[model samples]
Target: MEVAAKPAIRGAASIVRALEAHGVRYVFSIPGVHTLSLYRALDDSAVIQTVLPRHEQGAGYMADGYARVSEGVGVAVTITGPGVTNILTPIAQAFADSSRVFLIATNLERPFLNRLEGNLHELTDQLAVVRPVVKWAYRAMTADELAPAIAEGFRQLWTGRPRPVYLEVPLDLLDEATALAVEPATPPPPSEPAPHLIEHAAQLLRNAKRVLVFAGGGAVSRRVAPLLKEFVEAIGAVVLTSLMGKGALPEDHPQVAGAFGYRWSPDNPVVTLMERSDLTIVIGSGLGVRTTANGTMPLPTPLIHIDIDEHEFGKRYQPDVALAADAAVTLSALLAAVHAGARPREGWTPEEIAPVKHALRTPPDERTARYVPYLEAVRAALPREAIIVNDMTMLCYEGVRFLPVYEPRSYLFPRGFGTLGSSLPTAIGAKLARPDVPVVSLNGDGGFQFTLEELGVLAHYRFPVIVVIFNDSTHTAVKVAMHRAYPGHYRDVDLVNPDYVKLAAAYGLTAVRVASPSELEVTLRHAVEANEPMVIDVPIALERYA
Candidate 1:
């Protein structure tokens, strides 16, 4: 009988090798005694760069942000107990948005694992706590399992609808020596669309008189985007993007109707186009609360819906023809089936869409004029392709509805979770992922303070990112709600914040304060060209937009 020979290597070393083999370029993490071995193992690697974040939660968000823009798996590592718990918010956010991230967490040594005894960073069931939020969670009880667990995590990331995964390794196992043979991950082949369903979708789209195409976040895939553009042009259809789907087609494209649900007014161009359509074809979007205006926005009947996730097909509104497949694959097939000579559908003409486009792009009224200067400055100073991470603030709500983003993955809004403070960290991650492109985190004072610790991370990495903090001295969203409910009785919403300029200086970053649009343009132009991180503080009146 032949015995299998074991190779001699530390579990931590095996994990690093696995990550490198899988082509991971970055790992966002915090250092701890338990994770020292992992860091030491990382020292010799050239492909993977370990980024140290201020907080475990920020580390998680950095990974989340990276995954969202890069369209690949983002990885994060943390120590036991509190370290694992601190990152729950980001895990939940990834789950909600179906973002792909691999979270590597450490546990107590084998002897103390799950014993409920008083120990540092020990929880009764760490795996259980993370299981609900992640698509799958695995614990490595032995040294040899570490590499396999990582490979499995990557496999999960690539094979299904994008979601987060977790791998928990016991401290003793991480320190133990083991021989493990690991292989690089090969993504599973994309699922092909059914020919019958593809034909039906094409026929329905062709027969419809007034056709409207709805592109969701799921439609942002590289394989599907060009196909969507061609289909829209070939069919002579009007296209509307969900907030998550903003960059699926160029917003300036003549066929585009802009984003839906963000602008609550009836005059929203996308809303108007939707009303005129006799049939709608939804792609990639889940029609979630934000996209559907909390279920109040009206959608047309006789719909043809396509999605990668089968569960989302009829989740909201039943489709006349539901095709469950990847957006890129399905859209490609639909495009191939539609003959170029097919009679063009009778829908929105360029003349009809021009007024709607102009109306949506027009300047706001005097009451909300305070934000206009800053918005205009940002639009002018930043390049058209710059990435915008819109934080959850009063300004963000307006920007989400009205901001014109011209590239795919150019604008990232905290879609389902709607969490505050994710902007700065997420934007930092985006900048790291695409160093050639300019990235900006647009945040209000209240939201900026939530993840203020990340400024240190930026100073350490020295990546050029412009963080524009709107200093309104209050959580304007809450203030407005309170005023509506109890007029003149506003309390606790008024916030006192640190002088943002000084705060940025403390982090070794260039900081400037701007008041008017002209000042902002000058300050922002300088920040964009500078080769380091900078902060620009813009003071605006509280509730000015209300």
Candidate 2:
């Protein structure tokens, strides 16, 4: 008697197997008709945890955040056309910041294409829309190709300049089952820095009287902070981190100058140092517009830029010595070269760095009736080891500038995407990853509203997250900027907010609303000391913060 053969895996099942082989343990998605097959496939997979997001945008942001904190690729599955379109903002952000993510989108059946003049959720070209925002895009044509396509997508997302990759599979292909081998693809090794290039970079640092090291989002890797801290100490170089790179070195460290770019005013000393420095050694930073004052195109200082992505090497600002290498490797090499050349300078003491730090430090009396005293309160309330997640808004600046992050990945934000509604959910993911540390979600009211539904998720899991909401009662950042551009006219911008404290309480979480700066410290302290998810809504005047 012939033995029964193993049941053939088809369509969604095969795709699930491919994902498992890729080591994707968690996937965030919003169910849609086109993706129902894939969704069904995820039903019985014990290895994969499927998180159902309230909105497609939230799904993408969740994946983006998970990828950021995990330092690995994250997956987002969405239906074709409109579902895919809804996630463009997060996709663009992931691309901009070199986030490693895989967006698996299910498209309309190939045979049914153009059957309707303008079908619902039909796009003239979905790939074209996503091309500008992804590292790579593919439309799988066959069942056999699905596994390899996913493997390749994962490979692209992990190699060199890690970024989000989009893959579209037609609904028809989802039903076809065939025996296919899913093989894991190996990502190309990061390019190594040249010996001479390292020597030249070290030479520039040695020759300059006031050398400044500027770190960017690309530098916020597992090994980057320690490497950067060691290098800064060894050379006695003044250090500054971009808004996204805040935690690249410990903020309390004597060498840290401050943050640079938007939210951080151009007049800030960090920007001043960039202007005054004889040499600016930029490491692992893309020097993007947001981080570089929309390319303020600062001084003609000699520059040595090092990053893993070659496209980012001299794209924004040309570098005198551009080395395309892994951040950790380049930093290590530079540290060795710097150690051989010079001893720590006596003049570069902690006291010497104090004046700049003091100038940049938020003043105790800076609080106004309208703006919440975020920096002062957070500085006082949060523990030294708390993991902070900052949403995309003015709050990001305050959080990074004020919060003391001792290591890389300690702080999370959408520097590249600048996407709102990420703070709370990202905090949940971070808390799950690092349960020992206290996690705080720092967000503006507008940003918080984007994924406020996640409060239910937080409540269900009983994740202890201290959510600090800057309740400005409107999108103050945009409204103020609009007023600057068009003084008299009111476009539909200001939003009336709900009672966030009540909303939090409805979800079985503790909540408080602080109306004055005086009340901020006590409220924040109480929230931090709580055991369950809590929201501290601080009513603020947006105008003052602006």
Candidate 3:
């Protein structure tokens, strides 16, 4: 109300007011001299909560986590230059994963911008650095332009393909006074699914036997999941989720097979399922390298592809029917179209689906055996509703397939980018976004070291997160690959040590070292009961585990 009521306010105040109008609840921020004006406005604001993170990267990751779990836009703020550069990884990660992260950074004044000046925190082109990773990157020249820039950022964030949006306010603008407030974005709704596209997909499925539905992260939205479930069940199709699509269908559902389809090995059950199927419908996934296991996995012909972005239609494999529209809308139309033809199809039977679900739970090799129990222990210890945020680690690698997730948005991972050191701050953001729910994070000692400093932020803010670290003193993934490729020459794979129990204790957390899975489970239960931030160290050798 104050936004429009006031005749004019400073640029920083206008930015704050605009964010409030657009319903930004929390801002993951690290205050710096160039962005202090905005922080001052934040201090005086009553509605929005500002979170302080140790690093700009951590802040960006927190925003990413917040956005994914909350199913809304997550905002992060930083000072100029290094702030923008430091946040690049998170932006790239969000870009890869299609998270709605809004990044606001300050830039050098107009005269110095795009000019090679040695001013503090100055970059020749701040927008250029993040442009590739963000859906849109903007730099506002005047205080009056701040509101419109924010509106456009939200518009880009909500309208089409979801990705990170960047807006840089100049150092001069933050101090310039303008009585401008951000207006709520009024983007046009996504177009309805095309009749011809829906009819073609339905006709193909009607003629085919043994249909399969390959789902991805884009299929995991609230608006899309129920429609997806109805459509899959209506067609009697077996559901296989890509890593990002893990929980779109409940893993325990009779027809729902988890991420077992990610691997393309001949013996892989889902790959076999794909090979056997006459037709496949892919929804809300780009079918990227990670999802397709670097293109080792194959999709059969007569495929129906549905996505919000038309660019993804023929990026990898051309679909027989490509409906580039909102997933929910497309599924709804497809369901009606399929029902109209009403053909009895012989999709994968219960007998066939059983083995696939079995294959996911049963460890195929000794390497899988090492981490499957850990995920099982975690699953048994936490409720199905508890949220899990994962890092790039050996244990979490197993979690993509072995871990049973029951709902959409309940599990979070940088699955697309596989970025290291994101779980800690990501968990913090998820916890902050959904305070009533339990939040758990699994990290490797290697990746955890990247953003472990964010533990201080968690302790300081009293955000209770069950942080489980699989400490093997090496980057197990890289080491194993190196050892396999080069025999005895695994350089830089081994890591120097730290006493995690002692280290975590210093950060005001209840730190413990668990000796066994049983011990880890018991300690985890206690940590959950205690309802405080904690770190549990499980020391093992990569030689034995990986």
Candidate 4:
């Protein structure tokens, strides 16, 4: 008697199962011929939620934004060649910001690999192009290797210096069947803090009088805020946060100095404090070009760098002492050591720090009667907990400066990538992710035009996201920057905008256009109360803010 053959599993099926086992809830993608196998597998499985985006790039950005809010790995699936290339921008942004994301690309058949051959959707050295921008890039050669490759990708993504990972699955391999019994891989154990390194870091802090703490994106973990607050208060050290680390500490806290880089105001006090400090304790932040202004000058102080990734230390800037440990663990250990060597302190008072805080708190005085009314209207209409997503325009800078964020992640913007069309989709994702919280997307006229189709997605899903379009009728940010660069010359930067209110209504969403700023408050309240997807198109003078 012949034994029945075991059920053959496709490589794509194995990948889907691996992703599900790794706890990935959502997978965003734009379907193509190369991804048909995976699409079929996904359709057959009930483990993962799949979303189809109109554009591949939009899908990638949605994943990136979702990861930012969810604080977990986000996955985006795409076909080979153009599909994979289109997502590079979002993937690069993820890599730059150390965001956890997985990009699964379905490649052409193995016979057509890496040659100038005429195979459909074939690309020469695709993985090479993506390697520099990802934490790890893997190409599975066989069905048996698929599970282990995916497991490795997850390990690399979650390990030290977490970032986006890429896995390219060839069509031939995806179509092939296997009989191997794939056992689920065990996840690695969490890393522990080095006791000796913690003691050394503590000793440096205890001896220093003018101590400062620079917190980075990696320091934004859930427990980091309280741990940092405790450590800083114990050491009497002034605390500063990077742009990504904003709201890590309460802005009103006495020990909090201010945000270090990416300040709305040029003369930010945290920059001044960094320049004067004697000892700087950097926690979980890589002093990258943007964070440290391209490393033009060090902090003019002895630095103690603490992070999970050892390779990050002394990469761009030198450190006096480096502790390769998780931020929470290292902070906990350091706090204990510092408390043991407690000393009395004498330093600047709250009165001296008041001016710095006041300067940052001052609103932009674009006080045209119209502008004043508009600002007041928005402030009065929106709830304090409303999540505000801004576009990469002068309105965004104005919003960041004037609009208050009462909580962390409440203010979402593409600061690292500075992508224009991100606000609407990001707001949609944020609203869907947290239905109870009200979401407001502030987009410029130019930015809104890029992804206006997303309004249909909002309407279809019935997501109640409030969109406020700043109708300036131009790429005002570019025009202003060009004017400053040339001193007088104006180029092709102005634009003619459509009636956005009508555009919103066309997508089956509630829409209203506000011309006089006096109508802003009533219009906003009506939109909010409607409790449906709505747009409040506000016509504003760009010159006032820019």
| Best candidate according to lDDT | 3
- State TM-scores per candidate: 0.96, 0.90, 0.96, 0.88
After superposition, which runs of candidate 1 have C-alpha atoms over 4 Å from their true positions?
1-6, 261-267, 340-344, 363-365, 542-546
- lDDT tens readout by residue for model 4, 1-546: 999987989888888888888887788888898888888889877879887667777677777767766667789998999998988887887777777889999887877778858888777888887898898999888887887888888888767777899998889887788766545556555566777777666666666767777777777766677888787777777766666666566656787766643543335545566565678888877777666766764474678888788877897778888888778878878878877884224433566566766665554344422343555577678776666777786656655444444455566767777777878877776665566777788888898888777787777778788898888788888877776787567777788888887887787888888876568778777767777888888888747323
In order, what lDDT does every prediction score? 0.83, 0.77, 0.85, 0.74
lDDT of 2 at 92: 84
Give the per-residue lDDT of model 1 (tens digit) for 1-546.
999786699988999999999989999999999898888999988889989999988998899889988888889999998999999998888888889999999999988988988988889999999999998899998988888888889988987689999999988887799898887667888877788877777677667777888888888766777889888887878888877888898888998867754645555556777778878889987876556756566788788888778788766688888887888887778777776433336766878888877776665566455555567778788888898998888777777546777888778888778788999999988887788889998999998998999999888879788999988899888888888888887889889899999999998999999988789888888888885788999898836423
Model 2 per-residue lDDT tens digits across residues 23-45: 88888887877887888899868
In model 2, the Cα lDDT at residue 216 comes to: 84
> Candidate 3 has which clashing residue pairs, if any?
8-179, 9-179
Among residues 3 or more apart in sequence or in different chains, the pairs in candidate 1 whose N, CA or C atoms overlap within 3 Å are 7-179
Model 4 stretches with alpha carbons more than 4 Å out:
1-6, 180-193, 260-266, 271-277, 295-300, 315-317, 342-344, 347-351, 363-385, 398-403, 515-531, 544-546
Candidates sorted by lDDT, best first: 3, 1, 2, 4
- Where does the lowest 10-residue lDDT sum fall in candidate 3? 261-270
Whole-model alpha-carbon lDDT for candidate 2: 0.77
Say what the RMSD of model 1 is.
Answer: 2.0
Clashes of 4: 0
Can you tell me which runs of candidate 3 are displaced by over 4 Å? 1-6, 293-296, 542-546
Candidate with the larger lDDT of 1 and 2: 1
lDDT string for model 3 (1-546, tens) is 554466768999989988999998999988888888898999989989999999999999999999998989999998888888998999899998999999999998888888876789877677888899998998899999998899999999988889999998989998887866568788668667888777777789778888888888889988888898888778788888888887898898888877773354657766677877888789988876556665556787788898888888776777899888889888888878777874437777678888878876788887678777777888888878788998988888778888899989988988777799999999988988788878998999999999989988978888999899999899998988887888778789889979998998898778999888888888888887888898999997635523
